[model samples]
Target chain A: MKVIKTVNIFLAIAILILSVNLMKPLSITGSSVADLSDAECYFVNSGVSNDIPIDGCCYEVQKQLECKKTSKDYRCYTSESSERYYVVNANALNYCKVGGYDVKII
Target chain B: MSKLSEDMSKDVKLMIVLVVVVIILIFFNFDSYGVSGEAANTDNIQYEESTNTLYLDSLTLKQKIAQMVITYHKETNKERLQDLFIGGIHMGAKTSKEEFMNSIDNFQDGSIIPMFISVDLEGCANPFENFQEFPALNEINTKEEAFKVGYDEGKLLKEMGFSINFAPVVDLDDKIWKCRSFEGSPEEISEKAKYYIDGLQENGIVATSKHYPGKTLMLWDPHKYVVHAPISRNDLMPFEKSIEGEVSAIMVSHIIADGYANSENKPSVVSEKLIGELRNKFTGLIITDEIRMLGLSDYYSDVDQMYIDLFKAENDVILNFDINLDNLEHMISVVEKAVIEGEIKEERIDDSVERILNAKGVNVIR
Candidate 1:
């Protein structure tokens, strides 16, 4: 009886502690960030694309669309940020891969 | 009686306690479901056939402006809330059931026309402690489940005295992990959202599809940042689907649509460009996402102009829309003052009040 009482009291205490922990404020997790990469640097070096400039000290969005025979599962981060997720596709991914900084899959 | 073994008795005792606990939880669930809202005005909605212009004429310009402004209230102060003469009250999810009833009662008692009580029962963890926790829309997979969830939520909300729900975010950006969105392709969002819209509206609750024209990127939340969406007409398909599905209201976001809202690149809510686009598309209640949102607020140096511009852009309802009562009062005053100066006509205010009255089922015989 004594052992059972002791075990039940411990269990109650544990549950109480857990409820308190669950009520604590949670730190909101935001998305990850990265610096501009080398391929992007190469595109910057090649200043040929009319739509986008190669003066490239600043991080600006350049949208490039590529579609093939089959619409394979492709994901590009949005054509620009702040728009919601782009329709998941790879052409957008490749576009960001070539010229954008911090490209991500939608 | 046979002498039970000591261990067996202990086991029986534990089982009885577990059963009692389960019964208590069940009873608590019933109490949770038992919460109800004010039901005086909603029984009749013969709005298309007639309008109450007599009541409309009776309202002072300040009363009409108050009818246009919807504010978030945490407490149920009958005198103060009635004094504000606000048309709508957004009940926070955190408000307790008893207090929520009190708030609704005060609003009903205070106002001649019952205020449109709204809540965000987003089907995730409900913000209110006494309310039942529903699984997020993302957890729902099939059309049948979505309809059931939407119907039940709408019915419950009506019972709880909420005529409007700011939910089922139709934005294509599912990466933000708000769990408020129905994810997948835009088509999938449209298909699923139709049922949710129907479920709520059909049940007499106004379902509002939000963060309009699509919150395109997954990178940052608009609540914290000046979200920029460079979307084309093709991106607007989700809004089209939700509207077609018969949602009664659409909440526009403050996200700056670079290619869309205009060259000035104002957030869509205040922009004549985007809001004008919405007017072309939807004639229902065009509610703005909390007008106080940073995405829209940071742009206007003169905050009073923000409210003026929202209605100037022809936004029907402003949500949390003002900074404070003083700010709210000033915004109304400026709008009222503008009408008097002929910068804006009183007909515009009448048009807005008409929509609000119709939604609340305040109709005139003639």
Candidate 2:
């Protein structure tokens, strides 16, 4: 019985610790430096304009969408910097504006 | 026998104590589900079909606050929200047309005032992409195509029992999603948007012109936790046209602004200055975009404070998609407390409820 009591106490303590550490609400800690990767650089000129440049090396978004067959004016290109995702028409139009080389997704 | 009885007594006491502790925790957790401390206006709610009158005073303070909030639709929330008389249910991307219809029926089943059934059915941001395809706004060059798209989309949405369509994004530029904004100069965009608004509203679907105080589709600054947009005169034109066209509601974005339109460094959704300015130009419902977005929440240390600010901002409707019903109830309680304390006036609540009922085609009588 004493052994069981010790085990229960330890279990309760462990559960409390896990709850405090893991049950926090999710927060978006935005990037400090720009991520010019394809996934990050996508959605230029498609949803937003890239005419005016910001003071950054890369642009980060919540999500990156692929080029839809229906949208010809809206094309996505791969970013030469990261080689991971596609930067859309806006980013492709003015890749040099944001200080990066925009590579068209062939 | 006596020894056995004593041994059982200790174990029974321990069991009772454990059960009591659990009961207390459960009670605390579910407390948000019950009536809050606001002095409920007498529950004599009635609608006279003969006179077409809805007694506004009949609703309790909780019901009024519930009417101000539009929550994300979940199967679990249907019955609870029906009881709370929540004003609206926003449908996210769902699998099928049948699923969307069924969900709408379930939510509107026992609601006193028919809840506003809303969805984001824009050019590229189509939730109905699986079942049907709609032309992206950028692809629509002429006002004729824009009107046709709006009228067709509105007709289908009404058939599906959707009351509101958050579309015709009037942001002057769309550098992000090139397909969202209509392809043209500000004046041309305005003309197309006006035709779309007329098409939707004529079909009994409330058209909401959105991301107001403009420049929302601009790129974000990663260094800033809350994104800010530099608004220009061109950015205001589409919205001005939307108001002139008499759109039903305008959805506010989370971008902080300070140029032609100023949010005073606060996200436009919670900024009274911006909302108040828009109210001067438009008497329609001013709605906040999804309140759960990090851009709005990041501006506040305490989430409860954010809820209070949203109410104080005087928006006619608030979109909170927290998914947890308890958090929603907690939000209602916080606003109720603010109202009781005079931080937010009950009259303000009345004003919003009146507008909401008006939009729903119900006549409100004080």
Task: Provide C-alpha RMSD values for all models, in order.
Answer: 20.7, 9.1
The local lDDT score (0 to 100) that residue B92 gets in candidate 2 is: 59
- Please provide, for model 2 over B1-366, each residue's C-alpha lDDT reduced to its tens digit, 9 standing for 90 to 100: 888677666656655565565555445444433444443332346777676678888887778899998876467767778767789987755556897899898888766678999887885646675576788788887898889999999998999999999887888777655567887898999999999888898899999997887877765654454787888888899999999999999999888988888999899988889988988889999999777554676688677788889989999999875555666777887788789889998998999999999999899998
B44, model 2: CA deviation in Å?
Answer: 5.6
DockQ of each: 0.03, 0.06
lDDT of 1 by residue, B338-357 (tens): 67777776777788788888
Please give me the DockQ of candidate 2 compared with the native complex.
0.06
Q: What is the lDDT of residue B240 in candidate 1?
A: 92
Q: What interface-residue Cα RMSD does candidate 1 give after superposition? A: 18.8
